[model samples]
Target: MIGARVRQFRTARGLTMSELADRAGVAKSYLSAIERDLQTNPSIQFIEKIANVLDVDINALLKDEAATNSSDETAALDEEWQKLIAEAMESGVSKEEFKDFLEYNKWKLKQK
Candidate 1:
């Protein structure tokens, strides 16, 4: 739930509910209600304020746990691919050279 995610991040950052509410410029009681799931629907403006104070994207707070986990896994894979590309660039692999390699690999797969 959005509330749970919010609480998770807030606690992880060692922020008390009052502190988070104060930083987000929201009412402390309203924030408590949100964290406790007594209030489930918060306005986008409300979410934006909390998200900003938490330093997290609004999507992170809104996504389901499963979707968030998948997104996290995908992000890790993307980071790995980015590092590999950086290594290739550092090794002086030109864009044209990489394009040729891709074309050749495609053709080789077609031949099989």
Candidate 2:
């Protein structure tokens, strides 16, 4: 579950394992295991360490495999983004505007 979540979050952020490992100050191989579920029973502290570096709550990475793991907060964030994008579309915002928005947000995140 955590592996899937890690892979999902990493991919969503457009980061490779090595990139994330560098950001998180962890081993790429270890991160790989975390993504593959081969290391299923990683400790809570281990999970917390990774979560802290990722800027995601540990609970987001600790769901049952059978469940889809978007917490209410994450879902709310997504809904807000969707609404903004939809409003932009209705207002005829150009693709350039969207690209700029995404790039700006990504850059802002990097500043953290």
Candidate 3:
């Protein structure tokens, strides 16, 4: 289950197993074992490393597939939104700054 999620995020990010293993600093054999479900109980530190390399939250890698799929479907971003977010990230706009902008806009709307 966790392995599948790791593979899903990894592939979605266009990273091969070897790339992921190399970036995460884990052995390729060990990563392969995890993805194959041959190693079911990876340590928290290992998971953290993989999640960091994958650019995903740890829970995204740990959640059950069914639950994750349902939530992801409901939370899916449109392409424009995705592009905007990517642009914002590339421009170095911190999440806190974005949140502050949103709050300011909300307050402005209330005033109007």
Candidate 4:
């Protein structure tokens, strides 16, 4: 199931298995095994790498397609927000720090 989802997203993005593997820093053979369902239960970190490269939410890769649909506008907005959050996470910004920043921003907006 996860393998099919990975393949679907990868193809949808016009990325070959080799390209996806290279970009995600994953072994191509491992990625192939994943797509072929020879390897189930990939680590979260591996999924995260693929999701980052695919510019998709992790849930999209984990959940069934029927359950993942939304308005195009919402999907686009969510994709952008996911990218931003991923960037913050990669830069070592803790969730608490992100919440603090959001709270600060809310307070600043209230002052206007």
Off by over 4 Å in 1: 66-112
User: Which pairs clash in model 1?
Assistant: none
Against the reference, the lDDT scores of all candidates come to: 0.82, 0.74, 0.80, 0.85
RMSD score of candidate 4 (Å) = 6.3
On a 0 to 100 scale, what is the lDDT of residue 106 in model 2?
A: 100
Candidate 4 residues lying further than 4 Å off, grouped into runs, are: 67-112
Error of 3 at 81 (Å): 10
Q: Please report the candidate that would top TM-score against the real structure.
A: 3
Q: Could you give candidate 1's per-residue lDDT for residues 1-85 as a string of tens digits? A: 7888788767656678989999999999998899899999999999999999877789978886545455777755744664566
TM-score of each: 0.59, 0.56, 0.62, 0.59
* Residue 54 alpha-carbon offset, candidate 3, angstroms: 0.6
Sort by lDDT, top down from the best = 4, 1, 3, 2
Candidate 2 off by > 4 Å = 65-112
Selected candidate, larger lDDT, 1 vs 2: 1
Residue-level lDDT of model 4, residues 23-44, one tens digit each, is: 9999999999999999999999
